[model samples]
Target: MTLSFQRIAYEALNVCNGVTMAALEAAVERTGLAPGAAAIDIGTGNAAVAVRLAERFGLRVTAIEFDPVMADLARQRIDAAGAGAEVTLAVAGAADVLARSAPVDLIVALGTTNVTGEGRPTPEAGFTALRRKLRPGGWLLWGDIVWLAEPPAPLRQITEATNLYTDDAGWRAAATGAGFEVITGRISDPAEFEAYPRDAVTAVRAWLEAHPDAPEAASIRFHADRVQAITDFGRDYIGFGVYLLRNPD
Candidate 1:
């Protein structure tokens, strides 16, 4: 996707996954992070979650976004929220930030493609890397795609092209292997699952309709159609899951 359109698409979303903001708030509240605690929100597109962390949980947040364009937008969000260092923006890759970041009270990884580093991303790789970055008994709020069943080859190829994910059991096993106790997890409801991609595509369509003559309009539409097609087919075998995990004390 073109960088210009990518920004618009991201701006269209507050939460990348299918779950509602209320659901996320409930999960964060349950994590019991106290006021003035620290947090790092990786891949914080548009900084919605970061803002929420500060506004809702009263946590000091470092909002990380590797893309300069998205980071600019995120900066705008923080300013608009009239927040100070309560939510800081870190415009660096996840691995780079993790290398020097101090352990914090919480980590938010909602739809984050890479948590720990840049090597071929897997559930286990991400879980282990995160373990080293958390204080004992600290929390990790993870959200990502889950394969409900063995997906067909074509669908699998498309979904795994970016970051490798796994089934519900696999996610739990990986976290447990990395010494995290999986406190709880929730799978998206069927309607919720369908809405994620649908909304994304709708955002793109709305952009195209409004900017019919923009140079990148065709490219944007092409990518949007591809996304719509992929999700339409994989809906039966795929879902989004939010898991609350804790590093062992």
Candidate 2:
């Protein structure tokens, strides 16, 4: 099978998701995650957040990633970070992993809930499903893109087709409807928002230059151009944020 453009791009960039490290650390601190807490990181791209939760916060984390290539890389990184004992890497979709796993003290799903099922689940449904996997009084650190302003009709349709995001108000309502009390939230600064796609494009373009004769070069370049376009245009109307939510007892 041909490698997916997303997989190739993410692997080249060494990051599969967009949230920044600073945002992640801030979310952890805001959530007040305690040592020895049981946490689950859904869609753990490179297990960056998962490893940090385990190492920095002293939490035992179950990190789930659907893509095999990404999962392998996560495994390598987890081992390299010496967090093998504290972090369990699960190569599976979020819904599947949550199904078999016990309720945990914390759950972190950053921009990956769509992988939970076939159809695009609404934010309410997605948040509710993840909440089921958390223990009462537990915390959930959810991160994803949100609209900064209502885009024109064409742009809105284009974004909706790919991103499972809504405006900040809509997101807060969804969280409340899903039984989560929003405690604190952090929106990405303009620089952080620009950095993710900019860095990805840079990484992929560099890879393309170095591996001009590679079989996947065409696919990689195609994906890189598309991302660059989005980075240049779409970012103005959208922003990424991490929300710290609490599951009431």
Candidate 3:
């Protein structure tokens, strides 16, 4: 099905996925982390969460991304924030990056697993990979889109075909099996969003306008279109999810 487009405004602030930045700040405050705590954000796109953790809680971050383009953008953002040293943007997948890194106090894989592109990797395996990198009692914050109802055939086909996703319960079960205790889970409140797919669309549009002759414009346009389609259907049938899981202390 065809989808219309929306322009993203750079002036618009990014909204946190499910948990607001304020809530994340509160979590840090409650934890009473020392001046230099460590955190990792798996599949971190543009390092938004990593930047938030550092700026809000004074934590150092290791932001991992497999996509070079996205990782480069994140690196630019981190550097521009004057936080280059504070946040390390690793251009590697979760298993590769986490394996070499030290155990972190927190790991966030927000909206990442869906695109892992390998049958969702069984949440059990995903958690097992993450568990190795988490310090005992460290927290893992996972976020993704889940079906609000049995999705229409088109949406299901799009998701399954792309390895995108729709299994909130399965994630909970996997976390449980992986020895993680769920501390909390919540659907994202629209109010908390700062940066969004709209911004992404805008980014793509601007790139198209500037580089009209560029060879990659078609691919970029296609991505923007897909994002717009998902956004259009998301409100009614798809909900973004976030789960805060912890290793037993």
Candidate 4:
């Protein structure tokens, strides 16, 4: 895989323990989902968040992912983690999956919101989709990339227009539209921003050195530039944060 793709996937995966994980944990705790409360994880890549919710918080989880590969991976991981009974895997987009879901106690989208093809649908839009699937006072945990800087044209194009940029006010506005009250939100620490790229670069470099003749080596090297660009960008732009929203009565 290209370094950029790998980095993006890895970074998303890492969020399982970072801000996304913290946000989900907090949401679970704050919402006080009874031991049997149902929860859905949107864009549940690798379903790590879903498994975590069930295993840690004792909630029944339904994990929805758009990519078949990712959904399968999540299923495998959940099975291996012995959380299959607590988690269900579905291959579908968030907006679509939520459309079919009945009221639950919580909805979470971690790093998957940007791929929804609706322009990251402000928190308000996100909440609206989630609100339908969650009961009153239900919790919505959203994790997405926000602008750390005004991305240069080159970087923006290179990223294939997959980046999103939003501020606190912008997010709050969206949550209001979705019929939610913003409970708590915080940006990822600069340390996390710096560390992610640093680790991605490290992983890429090690792989390149070990497999210099691999067929995908060129592609990997080409995308290493993205890693460099992201590292440089994070110098100023704080890129991601987690927001917890609660449906109002």
Per residue, candidate 1 scores C-alpha lDDT tens digits across 17-95 of 7777787888889888789998999988888888988998789999889889888888998999987669989999988
Better candidate by lDDT, 1 or 4: 1
lDDT of 4 at 190: 75
Ranking by TM-score: 1, 2, 4, 3
**Model-by-model lDDT, in order?**
0.85, 0.80, 0.68, 0.69
Q: Candidate 4: what lDDT?
A: 0.69
Give one digit per residue, the lDDT tens place, for model 2 in 131-172: 888899998888888888887777777667745678888889
Query: Cα RMSD (Å) per model?
Result: 1.7, 2.0, 4.6, 3.4
Pairs of colliding residues, candidate 3: 13-194, 14-194, 14-195, 15-193, 15-194, 15-195, 111-143
Best by TM-score: 1
Which of 2 and 4 is the better model by lDDT? 2
What TM-score would every model get versus the actual structure? 0.95, 0.92, 0.81, 0.82
Pick by TM-score: 2 or 4, better one: 2
Residues 1-249 of candidate 4 have per-residue lDDT tens digits of 233335334534544423536555776687777888898887776567788889888999988877765666677788889998899888877667776678888888766654334764544555576677778878888776665566666655644355444666677777787678888887778776566566666767777788889877788777776667756754664466778888877
lDDT of 3 by residue, 138-223 (tens): 88877766667788888788765634555678778888998999877666566443236656577668767887776666766777
Model 2 weakest lDDT span, ten residues long: 8-17
